[model samples]
Target: MSTMTVKRAELKPGEVLCSYCTARCCRYFALPIETPETWEDYDHMRWYVMHGSCAIFVDEDVWFLMVYGDCKYLLEDYRCGNYEDRPQICRTYTTDECEYDNDGTYDRLFETPEQIWEYAHAVLPPKKKKKKKKSATEVSHQKLPIVHI
Candidate 1:
């Protein structure tokens, strides 16, 4: 099927930009999530990506989990079916920072579980190596106790 796209540069003065959009914003929803610091936190993010067409992104130092699900009120014509009664969040969405105005790019975006895992491995500190246990005879003859600092 053919689709129409209007560039921000070509928009005429005072013209509504959303009318020319394919409802990009309506096709996805993003909610802020806790920043992944530890491997476990990133593992949770990886789990989210494994579920479906979801993405984890870091934008402006904030992390978010984006799910690709079209709004039920989205019409075939790329308009809101319930425009008048749309929710407050949708109503407050401005075209200024919309996907229509510019490309929707994040600081760091991960679409697959492997990407999150790779990122976690790259940033997180290496795991400490485990010390081997001493033999029973060696331990019994040791002069000093093993002290972990």
Candidate 2:
């Protein structure tokens, strides 16, 4: 019997806390969003969220819209370019609402694209084309199943 091992990545909390790295999170991480539901609505959402590095989030009562881009003042060393005179939001940001404090887990929550799709799909109708049943002879003859759309 072969034993399989799955390796999990370890994060450095100290590196996140002590290092003055470029504000990568602010630069590239996405905002989450809450949406109105309709097939058309979801179709539009599918179009939008299907792109590179876009995400939607719903946490408790809050919603977020995420897009990938960097903060204007983020420097190469992970230091805030304007640390001394950072914007009010960044300056007042508390670790309490931070991913670092939370170990960046959407672990308790569904974080990936597929997870969100499953949630959305549950609320929507089945998207797969309904297939017509075939006789055993058809199977033996290698006939493709006919899909009824």
Query: lDDT for each of the candidates?
Result: 0.87, 0.56
Cα deviation of 71, candidate 2, in Å:
1.9
Model 1, C-alpha of 31: deviation from truth (Å): 0.7
Question: Where is model 2 poorest over a 10-residue stretch in terms of lDDT?
Answer: 1-10
TM-score of candidate 1 on Cα atoms, chains taken together: 0.78
In model 1, the worst 10-residue window by lDDT is 1-10
How would you encode candidate 2's per-residue C-alpha lDDT over 42-134 as one tens digit per residue?
555556667756656566645555676777777666567788988787877764445532444342234355655677688877777769998
Each candidate structure's TM-score, on Cα atoms with residue i matched to residue i, is 0.78, 0.52
- Rate residue 68 of model 1 by lDDT: 96
Off by over 4 Å in 1: 1-5, 128-149
Q: Which candidate is the best by TM-score?
A: 1
In model 2, how large is the Cα lDDT of residue 113? 52
Local accuracy of candidate 1 as per-residue lDDT tens digits, 75-148 = 89888889999999988889887877566788999999999988888999985778999999998888986799
| CA-only RMSD, every prediction | 5.4, 13.5
Residue-pair clashes per candidate: 0, 14
